[model samples]
Target: MTRSAASVPTFPGSTILGQFARSLISLAKAFKDRREVRNLAEFDERMLKDIGLTRSDVTSALAEPIHHHPSWVLVRCVGRPAEAHKMTAAHKPRPVVPLASRV
Candidate 1:
C-alpha cells in the first residue's frame, strides 16, 4: 500500500497554532479594511460619484461587518485613466527567458 504526503496526520499542537495564526491574520486584515473604508467616508459627494459610488453606498459599506470587504464597491466603480493604466501594467505578461540562458 502506498501513502501520499497528503495522508499524513498533522500534529495536534501544530494544528492549534496554525488556527491561531490564521485568526490573527484575519483580524489584521479586517482592521486594515475598516481603516480604508473610513478614509473613503471623507470623500465628498462629487468625488464619490466620480468613483461610481453614492454617499449612501459608502454609508452602507461602513455599516457592514468588519470582516466584509468594502473595497469591492470601489473596485466595481469606473476606472480613471491612471487606474486603467495600473490595471494594464498589472496584467502585462512577463517576458520569458530561454531555459539555456536561465542557468
Candidate 2:
C-alpha cells in the first residue's frame, strides 16, 4: 500500500464502500419485506392507500410465478393440462376407503 494513502482516516471502523454495500443490501431486503406485506390483500383499504397500491396489483402478483421455486413446478405450469389431469385422476379416492377422514 502507498504510504500517503495509509494516512487517510477510516472512520475508526469499516469503509464507506462496505457501508454502502451493506446499506444497499439492507434497503433491498426492506423493499422485499414491503412487497410481502403488500401481498396480503387482507389489509384494509386505508392501509392500501397509505402504501400507494391497489388490491388488483396484489391479486395479479399472486397469480404470477414466485421468484424461486422447484423447476418441476414451473414445468407443470407450462405443460399441457393432460398431465395434471392424469395425476389428479390417479390420486383421487375411490368410494371404498377415502384418504380424507371426516372431521
Candidate 3:
C-alpha cells in the first residue's frame, strides 16, 4: 500500500515555526558577531595587520546590513589573499634534486 502525501510526517525544521525560530537564532548570532567586530576596531592598525586584517576591513564589515554577520565579510577579505597565495605557491614549479646528488 502506498502512503498518501497527507499521511507523510514533516520534519520539525521544515515547518514554518521552526524556520522562524532558526531565523531568530541566526539574527542573534549576527548581532553577537557584530559586537566582536566592533571590539576589533579598538585594535591599532599594526595589531589588525598581525591578524591579516586592516582598519578598512573592519569598517567595511561594520558597514554591512545589521542582520548580516559582519565577521563573515572580514573572513572573506582576510582569506582571499591567503587562498590566492596558496594557489599560486601550489602551482609554482619546485627545483627537483637528483637522488644521486645526495651522498
Candidate 4:
C-alpha cells in the first residue's frame, strides 16, 4: 500500500493565504506602533469629542487613576478635580442681542 504525504500550512510561493497573512502582520505592527494616550488633560474637549468622551469623564479620570492591572495605566489617567475658584458658585451675565425690525 502507498501512503500520501501530508502538507502543513506555511508561507511559500506567493500563495493567496500567504499574502493575507503578511497583510495582517503589517497591520498589527502598524497598530502596535500607534501613539498611546496616558492622560485626559492633554486632550481638549474637541479631541475628546472625536473619541466619544465628555468633560466629566476627564474630571473623573484625574480624580482616581487606578486600574485593575498595571498594564492598563499605560493608556489611562485619573484627572484631579478643578480648583476651588473654577467650581465655586458664581453667576455671569449673558450678552443680550437686539432683534432686527420685523414689522
Best by lDDT: 3
Worst 10-residue stretch by lDDT in candidate 1? 72-81
**On residues 3-103, what C-alpha lDDT tens digit does candidate 1 reach at each position?**
99989988869978999999889878877887887898999998877777777777777777777677765555444446887999999999998777555
lDDT tens digits, residues 23-80, model 3?
9999999999999999999999999999999899999999999999999999899987
User: Which regions of candidate 2 fall more than 4 Å away from where they truly are?
Assistant: 1-39, 68-103
The TM-scores, one per candidate, come to 0.57, 0.29, 0.67, 0.27
Candidate 3's C-alpha lDDT? 0.94
lDDT scores for all predictions?
0.77, 0.57, 0.94, 0.50
Ranking by lDDT: 3, 1, 2, 4
Give per-residue lDDT, candidate 2, residue 24.
82
Question: Judged by TM-score, which candidate is best?
Answer: 3
Candidate that beats the other on lDDT, 3 or 4, i.e. the better one: 3
Q: Put the candidates in TM-score order, highest first.
A: 3, 1, 2, 4
Error of 3 at 17 (Å): 1.0
Please identify model 1 stretches exceeding 4 Å from their true place.
Answer: 1-10, 73-103
Candidate 4 on 1-103: residue-level lDDT in tens? 6655555455466588888898788656444433223354578899876665566665553444332222233234322223333555354456799989988
Candidate 2 vs candidate 3, TM-score winner: 3
How well does candidate 3 score on lDDT at residue 1? 89
Clashes of each: 0, 0, 0, 6
